[model samples]
Target chain A: MERPTLDQIWAWLDQIPDPEIPVISLVDLGVIRDALWKGDTLHLKVTPTYSGCPATAVINLDIQQHLRANGIDKLVLERQLSPAWTTDWISEKGRRNLQKFGIAPPPKDGEHGSYGALLGRVVECPRCGSKTTERISQFGSTPCKASYRCTECLEPFDYFKCI
Target chain B: MADKALFEFLTRIGDTTLVLGHRVSEWCGHAPALEEDIALANTALDLIGHTRMWLSRAGEVEGKGRTEDDLAFLREAHEFRNYLLVERPNEDFAVTITRQFLFDAWHRLMLISLQESSDQRVSEIAEKASKEVAYHVERSTDLVVRLGDGTEESHRRMQHAVDILWPYTGELFTDDETDRELSDRGIIPLPSSLEGEWKTHVDGVLSAATLVRPEREYAHKGGKAGVHTEHLGFLLAEMQVTHRAHPGATW
Candidate 1:
């Protein structure tokens, strides 16, 4: 029996959906930073979107369980803190998935250049594509999101907040 | 002695973040709005997560067996090294935002300078924390401007909160013997050095918000020396009660 390749493990991880936002996989979310095999043990580097995200534990467990099911017994999951995770790390596919799932993705130019830039973000409404959206709150249903309301559609939605 | 100073300095960072984190946690479901509710909770978690990192480093520097939990829950109020600003009660929504804004402003500058510390671990933690603090500063600054300039009632309340919290802000820049010692070794930046930039940032935001800077002569002090406000005891009691009641238990 041949050992599973790194690609095979990543493929399996691609199937693991985020617990909160089920439409996106962990890979798409950019939480799974790196993965490789060393000797008989598989090593993975994971970065949490928010340092205190409660979902991280669940996500870690899910990753472990998924990889474990693939017959890899020895696993090392390391939490990398430096070069912290950001909303910009969210993949293009992830942004599309977030939009399709009715949550607005962050701006393509998510650079928090200045205070004006942060407050001046014009996130299009996921449902109506309206530019006349107002932020209801800097926080949202989850730590990683912000609550915004579309003036045109009169709809409220979550925005994947820029870190 | 350098190791001891490093340990002390790290605890100061850890304790202040931990206490403020706990204070913010008290606002979990009680924030004025659902979005603020989530934001405040997220901020609390971020601060607490930072507490774990700094305290764990402190423990390592101290060469002691005490874990982060041991330092956090087990310490008495007098043993705690958090700023009086952080331990003060969250009087209201305005006051909470005011406290956060003031602290975040100084914290951002402090972390930015610490990123250049000769101590690699300290520098790394500072680098990571600087990113989070940037967002925190932005969040508080935006809220401060909104509330301070929003309406007659909001402006009045925000002004009151800023005045009430002003006395505590002075302690953030006052360095002590340990800080001075650390500065000599390039282990930590001088606290006073960051004050100029901190004041500029605060002034900019307050000007934007149409709020006045308080000129009260009384600046609360001694949190660095383990002297805290009367409120810390109660805050610690509530924070530690769960851990104390059920020692060695895990979820």
Candidate 2:
């Protein structure tokens, strides 16, 4: 059999939705960090959305089972802990899907000031593109996100941590 | 360093980080702002990671049957050797921030000194945690100034929190025999040396926040001796119940 490409592995794994947030795929959530084929066995590197996240084990099992069901019997999942996962890894399509799923997408590019930037920089609404958003909490539904309420849309949403 | 002394010292450090991490993790989904929530959770994660490393080493040194989880969840309230400062209740955001700021300041000095510890494992954990604690202190300091000097209501709350927490800060610098022995053997930071540095860092932040540094008096000690406040029992009851009930239960 011809070797499966990274793209092929990603496509196969795209069917794996996050155990907690089923609305989004693992790829969309940027949890699957790297995938490679080693002969007949496939090695996949995954980073959890948060440290000690309960869903990581479930997600890993799901990935292994999903790939096995697709005829890739030899599967290995690697967990990487460093250079921690960030919201910036979320793809544009993933952000759109997040919005469609009613979870506010991350802020658009050039919105909130980067780290070391001066404070008081406003964070805009991921929905309706409104800049009049008020922070509801430093915490959100998950450890990787914060909660923000949009004045324009009158809705509360999770803002994926930029870093 | 003597094996027993080193073992006790490591356990104390591990216990402090672990309980404090547990306290901070409670705020995971309940912060007043999402950004701050993530930041706080991340900090908690860092501390938990540090706890794991330190506890694992402590377990190794003791050569006892206790694993990290065993040490963490199996210990009774009085058995835990965390500082009194870390065990204080998280009253409000102001109180939490104040507690963290004080810890971060002391921790930075402690870790920096431990970076030169004779024990390789202690040095490694301290080196890694020092970097993370630096960020925690910086963020807490920034928030302290903003809230302390911000609106009238915020200033009042921040000041009140500071006043309430100031007493606990003294115990952080109170070197007992364990600390003295460790410092003598170069296994840990000298409390005397760290006090000045901690004072400078904390005083600078307090000054920026327009908050007064409370004068030192008879500080509450004995958490190091496993004598905790009434709050610790409840905290441990909640934390250790599952582990104590199951006894070696693993998922």
Candidate topping TM-score: 1
lDDT of 1: 0.87
User: How does model 2 score by TM-score?
Assistant: 0.70
Give the CA lDDT, 0 to 100, for residue A85 in model 1.
76
Best by DockQ: 1
Q: Write one digit per residue (lDDT tens) for candidate 1, span A20-127.
A: 999999998988889987888889999877766789899999988988888878999998876767777788988899999999988757564233557678889999
Least well predicted 10-residue stretch by lDDT in candidate 2 chain A = A110-119
Best by lDDT: 1
Q: Tens digit of lDDT per residue, candidate 2, span A12-99?
A: 8888888877778899888888888777888888876554456877999899888878778788888664444656678787877776
Listed in order, the DockQ scores are: 0.50, 0.12
Candidate 1 chain B: 10-residue stretch with minimal lDDT: B126-135
Worst 10 residues of 1 chain A by lDDT: A108-117
For model 2, what is the C-alpha lDDT against the true structure? 0.77
The DockQ-based CAPRI class assigned to model 2 is incorrect
